[model samples]
Target chain A: MFAHPFLQNAFLAGTFVALAAGLVGWFLVLRAQVFTADVLSHVAFTGALAALAAGLDARIGLFAVTLLVALAMGALGRRARPGDVVIGGVFAWVLGLGVFFLTLYTTVRSGTGNGSAGVTVLFGSIFGLTASRAVGTAVVALVICALLLLLARPLLFASLDENVAAARGVPVRLLGFAFLLLVGGTAAESTQVVGALLILGLLAAPAGAAHRLTTRPLRGLALSAGIAVASVWIGLTASFLVPVLPPSFAILAVASLTYLGAAVGTRLRGTRPTVVER
Target chain B: MTGTFSWNLLADLREMWSLPFMLNAFRAGTIVAVPAALVGWFMVLRRQSFAGHTLAMVGFPGAAAAVWLGIGATVGYLAFGVLAALLFALLPAGRGGGDESSAVGTVQALALASGMLFVALYKGFLNGTSALLFGSFLGITSRQVVLLGVVAAVALTVLALVGRPLLFASVDGDVARAHGVPVRSLGGVFLVLLGVTAAEVGQITGALLVFALLVLPPATVQVLTTRPARGLAASVLLAVVTVWVALFAAYYSPYPLGFWLTTIAFGGFVLAYAGRAVVDRIGRLAVAP
Candidate 1:
């Protein structure tokens, strides 16, 4: 498994993505912004398309656009913050832009005539990414984790209670925006290996599963990251060994199953899952 | 480039009449717009947007499984979407705290993963798999246009019949329940309606862009006015116009209809948003201390 470069790249990229997804996802769930993360995933798709349309590396567009949009979204609702209705509105518009870019890439790009790039971006082509690109993804994932850690306490405070955190002089708005940026970064990097749609499943499943199992915040976050990493590791190994399962499906199944198992276990044991109710 | 540009814009517009598929596309876009906006309006009002998004995604697996089972993808899309909607209702995100989100997210993840797996496994004739997300343009036929029309008509009729009570329940379920509205039943029915719409829209736009027709127009309209009648009118109008123009653009260009529609819808939302912001500033200035 290690000898194959594609497999190696997939493993490295998957590891980085899983680690960041776990850490960021814990905060994402804590903030009750899973939908926000979903929005960023769409943003990533649009950015990737825009980049491809412009003939630049899609990763650049993916990361930059997602980071900017996530921040902008996080800043919304200060006064008359629009609800899911408004978010749904933005969701539609962004996807339109994504389609526009995808069309341009498919029609105007010089060499890629088959229009398969769009599919690859949506479904992910992680196994085909070069070793260096995979390594770069890993590094970016590390940076995202470090920044998230530095802001964790403040962010957690804000997520728990915006008004209270603001009264205590926390930079709630800025932290909220920063948290989205981290999510954007993680989604973009992970999409390199797992693809856009699959990234969502991988990103949410582990943190959700962890949240269902524990009461301690830090422990939950740790557990979330651990579950994410294990999902990726096991998913990759399964894909490698069986050669029948697609990595994305395998990874999603593993993480979602963890969540499912935990959900059932909590019900069976009748232990109340401890989470802060906002 | 000059030769292609020689036709005046209106001449290009008239050319669509000559193309049957383009006509069908126009018809489908126009017909579906109303129901999508209407149902989407209620979905937003109900704060079931998360569930709505998941429902859109659920169609992917439905379509894929349909292909695996040697059926039309549209059949699968509706089948999967409606089932998921009913399931979400059964699980009821209400009162579960953040657990509601967990359930919805898990459902979406599982649906999509299975869709992927089905696609990977099926050895039969499979086409338009990408259309499950980016949508199929120029693929719209008269048959599809009629199917969409039928679904839209049925869903719209149901929505109208139940509009008053549904609106009450959506805004304040507990109050509506206190007032004798069948809150639980309404939730179930609305999910089913949403599922049908999702499947209908799934045929025109891909799963990924479902919100374009369903959510954006209504969202913009809601912000533009406080009056329900006015908002509903604006939403339907915007939706119809967005798709009509989008279909026209798609017919003339290489881009798919969903993209053009989404972009146009997005542009409309932004314009309305900025306009609202400007009005607010002006009002504030007038009241300045």
Candidate 2:
């Protein structure tokens, strides 16, 4: 699995992205923001295309746009009623922009006589990423993981207990905004590896499966990242053998199956019923 | 600049309607908007927006499988959507709300991934995945238009019969259950209705933009009104007006119909929110310092 150059890049890229996604996903789940995490994936779709429409690197728009939108969602969600309503509003808002950007990218490409080589906004083009780009992606993912570790203590405090953490002078709102930005970053990176639409599976599944097994924050976090990285390894290996279907979908499948397996396993034990996080 | 501001709106409208496809597009849009808005209103009211969204996501796989199987894409959409809906309904009932969403989220994520897999497996897929995002709305033929009419008629009529009980159940499931409304069964029925509506709207707006059509208008309307009947009517009205205006704009402009529809719908929501905030401020001022 590691001998081929393209395969190496795929493995490395998937590893880094999954690690970051898993770490942030634990917080996303604990915070009851899986929908928000999903929303950021959609935003990343527009961000990448919006970049190409302006003749810039797709990665630049991918990160910049998602980070900004994440901040905006965090701020707006605080003021909006019925949290689901806010999420729905954001979904519509981002999708409209994605449609606009998609049209713009297609039209601009056709007009400029450029080959249709831009980012594939529908599912992503992870299989086509060059080795150098994959390395850069891994480096960014590492930086994101490091940043997450720095904030892990307070972030968990806030995620587990917002009002109590706020009363403890934890700057809960700031942490929320900051956490969303991290989610946005993870989303942008994950989009490159599995496309935007599938990022939700990568981010949510591993953490969910880990949560199913254990409730302790650190153990669950480690287990989540482990599951995520393992999913990538197995998915990449499976795609290598097949080489037909894209690896992103395979990665998502592995992650989802892990969660399902864990869900079933936990149910069988009858010790831990799935707790609804409020 | 091709579609610069025109003073003679009527002339532009006349020119647009001259084309048969444009007429078909508008006709289809008109049909799909009603039930979408009606169900959308209840979706938001019941706080099932997440489930609604998950259903929309499932439509992608539904449509993709339809194309892969050489059956019509419409069949795939309805089949996959309804299948997913049944699956969601079957998730262990009444586990804490949190567990249900997680399960729903897991199903949604898996469905989306499976959609990609199905598209990839089709080997002949050059554009099927993208179609799942934007849909092929501009090329509506007369047959599809007629199909749209049948679907819209059935969805609206069913909604009419179930609308009252559905709303009561949505507002207070426990109370409705006490009143012999079969709340659990009604929940299943509503999810199925939502599935059909998603498949219907997926034809107009594509799976990606389905959330816009199904979630935005009703959410915006709810932000403005609390009265049940009035709110329902307003949501449907908003859906109709936005679709009509968006159809007109898309025909004259160089954009896909779904884009114009989403933007116009979002614009309505934002404007309503601002109006509500302003009115609330005035009411507060009148009541106190």
Candidate 3:
């Protein structure tokens, strides 16, 4: 599994994504904007199509649009903000754009008889990874990791107690926008290996499972990164064994199972009831 | 092309009473919206909106895979959604007091990654790609209608029957658990209902926008009302109205139903919020008298 170029590239990509996702996702989970991040993935999709339509690189388009969208979202809500409403607005508009772009792309192409190029972009072609693609993913992941490390404490403070963090002099708005951009960049990089639709799993699942298994934040983050890497490796290798299975599904399956295992473990532990009350 | 919008939507509206396909779209939209409103109420109340979105995203890859393999996408989608939901239900709720959002967010990511991988394998399915994005309310067959009907009925019935206890648990989980309401069990049950809601809505709204109906209405209702029954009523009304209006708009305006419905729903929310703000301001001025 490790010997194959595709698997090796996937491993490297997955590891990088795991680290970034582990850190960013830890904060995302804390902020309760998980759906907001997922919406950005759809936004990324529309951006990809727009870029392709303009004859630009899809990845660059995806990152750029997602970054802009994230900034717009962050700018909407201020201290004691109604962030969810803004997120909700962005979510609907972005999805509407995705559908609209697809329709436009298809209708125009059909008139010219160029044979559906847009459809291929949606499903994504992860097996087409080159050394450069792998290297690009690594660079993005490293930058994200470094930024996350610098901002981790302030971010944790903002996430856990926004009012207090702000009163304590954290630039909460800038940090929030920066974190959103980080999530966007990670999502884009992960999209290359896992595709846009499923990158959320790489972003969210390992951290979630780790959250369940531990209470300490740093320990949880470490566990999340480890779990994310393992799930990706397992998924990439297993998909190869099945021949017809897509690598994204393999990543999802393994991650979901890992989550399942952690969940069951927590349930059986019966230490504390497994339901939160608001 | 007609630049002016007319009663053209009425043609689709009237045909809905006569044509099986049109009727199916209406029926599908209505049935799905009921459970969507109900389960969505809890989703909003508990801040579990991300879980619902994640369940829907989980279904995307399965739907894509089903299309690639020439199978029913709904079945594949349902399987993935249920799995994701159960995993969610099994996590320790107060492990770090941050378990809910963090856990759900992570799983949402995992589900999405899996979906992308599966979608990639089927390199040649036109319907699969379109179906995953825009959806085809007009394209649903009688078989899908029946399937959706059964699932929707089960989901709505469960939601209705469990309404009181679920509310009890949602409003104050610790109190409900102390009173022997089986709070944990209800949480699990709610997630399953959310899973079903995602599957049904996935047919009409596509997997991505499923959260629009499942989360938005109830959440908006939450902003306006404090009473549970009022909130439920408001959510249902908001959802049904948004769906039909969007359905009509899509039928006549030459735009996809998902886009139009989302637009209408979002517009309605803004208008409602604005109306409340204006009314409150006027009431304050009047009180000065």
Candidate 4:
């Protein structure tokens, strides 16, 4: 299945991104910060577009923009009851800027004026992966995964019960900002391989699906990571057969299947009826 | 810079009335905003704002994929929208406080990325996908208007029939369930209805502004009233009015309907809040309570 050099790089890149997404996503699901993740991912788009407009590497630009945006969201979410409004406003503005920047870039294409810039910015072709870009994406993903592992316990403590964690002097607000940064980095890394808009699915679905199978936090994290890795493996293999199929679809189709399987397994495992009171 | 009142603006508005398609577009926008505003009120009350956004985003890929396949955009939009709703319904209930948001977010990401990929697969697809994003009310055809009309009618009818029970469920799930309201079933049924509403509105206002319609009315009412029924009634009325104002403005202005609707909805919310603050201060001073 992995005969081509492109396929080899795609598989490696996919694994790193999926693993980081799975880890951070586990906490994201636990904390109910899916909206934050969505906003951060969109921020990455604006950053990438800005990079493209400036004739720079889109990945670095995406990571920088996303980190700053995520930190700002963390600050806002800590202070306000309607923090979501802030996130929503930022999301809209970033999207508007992305569209505007993308339009400007396309209109002023460097005589490759043949429309290649628009394609790269919009769809992000994984099949045409150069070795260097793939390696860079993989390394970034690995770094994100490492950061997630190191902060796993503190992040989980705060996510599960912020009040209790704060009582215990766990630095909950700081941890929240840190977690948001991790989410941003993971989102940026995953976007390189799976594309930006779909990183939320890759991050949240496996973890969300795992949450369905069990309420135990540690077990949930493990299962989330396992499910994510398995999905990357399956998606890589599936994309081989249908070369026309995009990597994002392969990841989605596989992750969705895993979600269904976990749901069914959980239902079947608890068939014993609870005593009902009239 | 084209000044806000530059001759181009005048020319744009004058030429807008000259075209039959522009008239149809205006009619289409009016028809859409009614149901969209009404349904959007319930959407916010039910705390499905983020879910509604996600559903719209997922519709992106469906539309994009359809564009790639040389098919009608509406078919793709509705198809993906319904599929997303079903996915949400089938997931375990009460899994998280943001069950709808989580499911919708996951699906939105997948839909958006996949749409991009499909558009990328074929060359020369940038222009086609642009319409799905920014949208064009000026060049809308008669067929699209009919389709939008049908979608709006079906969504509104379903919403009306289930509105009471859904409202009950939204206000107090436990009490409703205790009274044999089948809260879960109601959620599933309403999600399907919302799926259709979202698809139609998503086409008109883009995914983002749909939230404006959903969130603004309820939020505005909350600033003024504490009674549930009164709040709901006021919310629906406010939504309808905002839609009316936004539609006419979009018709008169050169910008897209979605942009105008968002700005108008936000403005309406601000106005309502400002009025409430003024009234509260005046009443406090007079009554000395």
Best TM-score among the predictions, by candidate number: 2
Residue A52 C-alpha lDDT in model 1: 89
Q: What's the true lDDT of residue B51 in model 1?
A: 78
DockQ of every model listed?
0.60, 0.55, 0.42, 0.30
- CA error at residue B58 for candidate 2, angstroms: 1.6
lDDT per residue as tens, model 2, A45-129: 8898889888898889999999998887777877211278888887787887887777787786777654333225546666677
Runs off by more than 4 Å, candidate 4: A1-4, A54-56, A78-93, A108-123, A214-216, A271-278, B1-14, B64-71, B98-102, B110-124, B206-289
Model 4 is docked with a DockQ of 0.30
Q: State which candidate has the highest lDDT.
A: 2
TM-score of chain B of each: 0.93, 0.94, 0.90, 0.85
lDDT of 1 by residue, A68-147 (tens): 88767766755212257666777777887887787687768847774777767777876788988989999999999899
Give the per-residue lDDT of model 3 (tens digit) for B39-109: 88888787666667778776776687677678888887787778778887886564433456656655665
User: Candidate 2 at residue A105, lDDT?
Assistant: 78
**B276, model 1: CA deviation in Å?**
2.0
lDDT tens readout by residue for model 2, B1-289: 1344476988776776777877787788878888899999989988888889889889888888888788888888888888988988887776534346656777887888788788788976755566676776667888988887897788788888888898888888889988999878778888988998998889878888888889988999999989988988899899989888887777667887777888888888889889999999999999996
CAPRI tier of model 1: medium
Question: Each candidate: what lDDT?
Answer: 0.80, 0.81, 0.73, 0.71
Cα deviation at B24, candidate 3, in Å, is: 2.5
Across B11-83, the per-residue lDDT of candidate 1 in tens digits comes to: 7656776677777777887887888888988876777787788898888889888978888877798789889
